[model samples]
Target: MTTTPRSPAYPSSPLPSASPPSPAPSSSALSSASPARWPLLDRIEGPADLRALPHHGLGQLAAEIRDFLVTKVCATGGHLGVNLGVVELTLALHRVFDSPRDVLLFDTGHQTYVHKLLTGRQTGFDRLRRAGGLSGYPARTESAHDWIESSHASTALSYADGLAKALGLRGETGRRVVAVIGDGALTGGLAWEGLNNLAASAHAGPVIIVLNDNGRSYAPTVGGLARHLDRLRGHGPDAGVADPAPTAGTLFEHLGLTYLGPVDGHDTRAVEAALRHARSLNGPVLVHCVTAKGKGYAPAEADEADRMHGIGILDPVTGRPPAAARGKESWTSVFAAEITALAARHPDLVAVTAAMLRPVGLHRLAEAFPGRVFDCGIAEQHALCSAAGLAMAGLHPVVCLYATFLNRAFDQLLMDVALHRLPVTLVLDRAGVTGPDGASHHGMWDTALLSAVPGIRLAAPRDPATLRELLREAVEYADGPTALRFPKATAGPGIRALGAMDGIDVLRRSPHRPLDVLLVSAGVMATPCLEAAAALERDGHGVTVVDPRWTHPVPDALPGLVARHRLAVTVEDALADGGIGSALRTACAERHITTPVRALGLPLTFITHGERPELLARAGLDAQGITRTVTQSLTPRSTP
Candidate 1:
């Protein structure tokens, strides 16, 4: 979505005569030429330092902060566009309200980088989104100013509601709770729930909801609410009319909130005035601030697709990643190509995404078959139930989402799709230990959660070929709900199957030596499992590796295969507890198989941010780690 820049009617009067605002900080003010690029930004150690700046100087400081953000975030990689958009808004918020005590909560915390910088965490940007460095989203441990830590969308308002209630009960009536929710976040059902509760509980202190309308989520905000917001903003300064008073008949006003201006989010003075007015209300208020997602920066502003919402390390000036990092075929690309091809072949096939049309690879399908793709806006639960409806009709629905986000729609998937035994295929991208984005962003929990679904068939692809094959299989399976999950990493070369036993694809076999070990590889775990098998063979043990393309339901031949081997180990890029390994173990037990079954996967814990390989190795799911585990299992141990 292209954001139309608005020319706010800033005050035309000259600076005051007494206590005139200081001029923008010059480079000469720095102690040294080096490490002093952002002289104005360098001065800000906290919100107090920012608040101390004069009004005129704040504009220059905002520019410096944007420059600082681009320089630091481009090198480290982060939510650059959103943060860039909120520079002045964040400044205005900190200036008008005292944080830590006032309680400023940001929905979809990726937009909190500016807030982080103003809160004395500028130095941490050097290692932004890295292991043992700064987290991508707000972390409660990072600073007292950061109250909540969630990257998930549509959660901040609910947090604000609860915080407001707690503050009221504690008799801390002076402390205000502000929730800065985006138009994208507002589309979710939970956000409406919070709005409903906040409106109903008129006694639960004042809550200033700053609607940061950047006109986009991963794409442009969709549905009825977006149109309503557009209507509210249509009659503003951009329309060449006088700055109107708080308009009535707004969605917020209808919900019992005092509706403030569709104020220019970039205009510090206007936003500050609006926030102050909101703070004075002593009840629920909404200050709708219209912003350009990639304000100021030429490259980001010009970007049509997502406006660089999230990015890898890139050249700040060019706003382009290095050649090596560019055009690399990822699992998402594979799915995009396959899905587009599939859509063309099947006229009855349709796709659905939860405000992540582009991120989850449905953009290809949407482009190819325009009317067939549905953009459900940050509402995953609604997406699934709607998909269930689509299935109940005649069309086959492929519901695509990030594996982490799939957690939000579990109940819908179970009751609506699986219970009805509808033909729905869930394409779960980033389905395993996704790196850098941290614990909340990781897709490691999907396999465990999906395993609990009664009639859901889950498939984990080992490579691009298998991904394409399995996706077609999943879409064609009209028996029940089916899901195809893959990681965020590049889809490497396909692993050629040595043979097939029932439905399992055997990748490796030890012919000469006796059947000693069976290696069960799930999805992309085949590569590492093969390495482990080769290592075991060198250590004088017969090892066989297999991939159950569809991992759920426990392949019929699996228990029989396990019975032939002395030990059976299932390796997956998912939780060890309820993952494919757990399913296989149960299957073997049911068949009275005597072979010892070992589940080799991620531990039941919140995995921190790091490189995918490093995290996998640390969890003993890598080739070296898998080999070590097998070797240890083969070795004799003395009694303690």
Candidate 2:
């Protein structure tokens, strides 16, 4: 599918002034209105007020709410399309159920902006995804209304099951549990697993599964199930329920939940009526609500490319935002260019992604060589296994997945691919502190996970050039499994000539002072390390910063570098456990080099949502933190 070559919108633009509807809430009217007012939601302070108003006013309110969201998110920058699609549904949800009592959970959490707007967080929208601002995803820490802090897709059902089960266990049956899942999320195996478990439980609680069918994933959600949804939605309400065969039809029905939908999700009354009916019924019932991804927005409506899956800043009038000027190429863009370049040279070269194409920058490869780029739905396991099979068939399979999602195929990556010693290159995108999406999406665990696989060589490049070089080396090295990782953001000017043999390279040096500390940084986190080294140098301590292009197996010349310095520091964007930091410590221990080494990365805890720099700083992976750690280690300890 050839997408219109439109310039991509960037997130850097300042949001335009929120054109709130005329007549802000008056003091007397606000006091007279219901006390259960959603405080932060100035536009929609209370659903009680909405229910009290005439039906015609409800539609007007929905329009105002959409405009409000657009304005708020434009300033803050958030999941714009998802929130846009759910304005009416969100209205209906608020209208129908008494929330805080009725448990409403968002599937991928991107659609929660509307929910947030309704639940007294309208002002917080201005700080959306910012450093000290409100989070992009729902956080229990943010509000009591937010029950589950879900950012990852395909998890609402599981959360619903567990919550519902726990409610039953506690003998608390007063509340209604509603889970809003998306069509894209249905591709994940966990959704099905949750469905099966929910079905098997004898003592079931009040759980309503709302399937928000948008007919799109990161890419146009590919699979037989997606095709089935098309048929179901196309059949409309007139298509009465009847079993064609003896076996339970539909995946959800097969799992034993009462399947009821293909409803017009855009229509507020229809969705509310369907939801009201589902609420009346006991046990688990799947209510499939069919809605457009970028609903009510003209430009997004015209957009065929995966329903404009979250653009940068957008223009309110035209729905087209200012694009970021091209500077240094992003790691994703670099990877895509190199993959396309390599694919042209070797016919055997093939690329695969587990639902991600545009985000991973594989769109270029898909456009250049359409036949070779295989988007194996959202099934990461299938993608990895398929890559293994492709390798067995003499094709160089490059399985591209997000750092977090690649964890799903660990077994397949180990036994099927690595054990077979297949020529499979796993390209892990978003390999570090992923800025706004929160802990669930961070690619921090890939290096550690992939490192455990015997014979699997892991290459983490610091820049675009080394990324290209590593890809070439990975493609050429037909002996065993090779993995490459980069950050969620852009790659800086990477030093290619680490050494003559393309091994570890010392990026920066200090001429004035002695080499007191050796800072080893991997992947995109090297930038901060360099800055830290510079800071230490000014403080009268010389620091040698090195980028071990390939983090796994610890480079041969690294020992010599370590021996030269009195203090050593291993800095990476990954988690401290089993990551590059651990590897360096182990190397020092094994080599019998008693260099006082300090390991710095993400701590052994789940981090919350924030901007990239803020999250890094909190994790102690930022330049200031790195300098402090190095400086402390370099200082002599006094004993009285």
Question: Evaluated with lDDT, which candidate comes out highest?
Answer: 1
Residue range 74-146, candidate 2, lDDT tens digits: 5555677777777777777878777777888998888888787777776676677766668888888888778
Candidate 2 yields a Cα-based lDDT of 0.76
lDDT of candidate 1 over 1-640, digit per residue (tens)? 1111222222313212212221322333322236767778889998888889888688778877777777778788889889889988999899999988899999999999999989999889888888888999999889999898879999988998999999999999999999999999999999999998987785688999999998899899999888787777783333334335444256676667777777878778778887887898788888889988878777888998899999888877788998889777899999999999988888879999999998888887887789999999999999999999999998899999999999999999999999999999999988889988989989999989999999889999898899999989888889999999999888888789988989899999998898888999999999999998888899889999999899998889889999998888899999999998888888888888878888999888998888889999999999898888777776443579
Candidate 2 versus the native: TM-score? 0.87
RMSD of each: 4.9, 8.5
- Lowest summed lDDT window (length 10), candidate 2: 3-12
lDDT of candidate 1 at residue 78, scale 0 to 100: 81
Which candidate wins on TM-score? 1
Q: What is the TM-score of each candidate against the true structure?
A: 0.93, 0.87
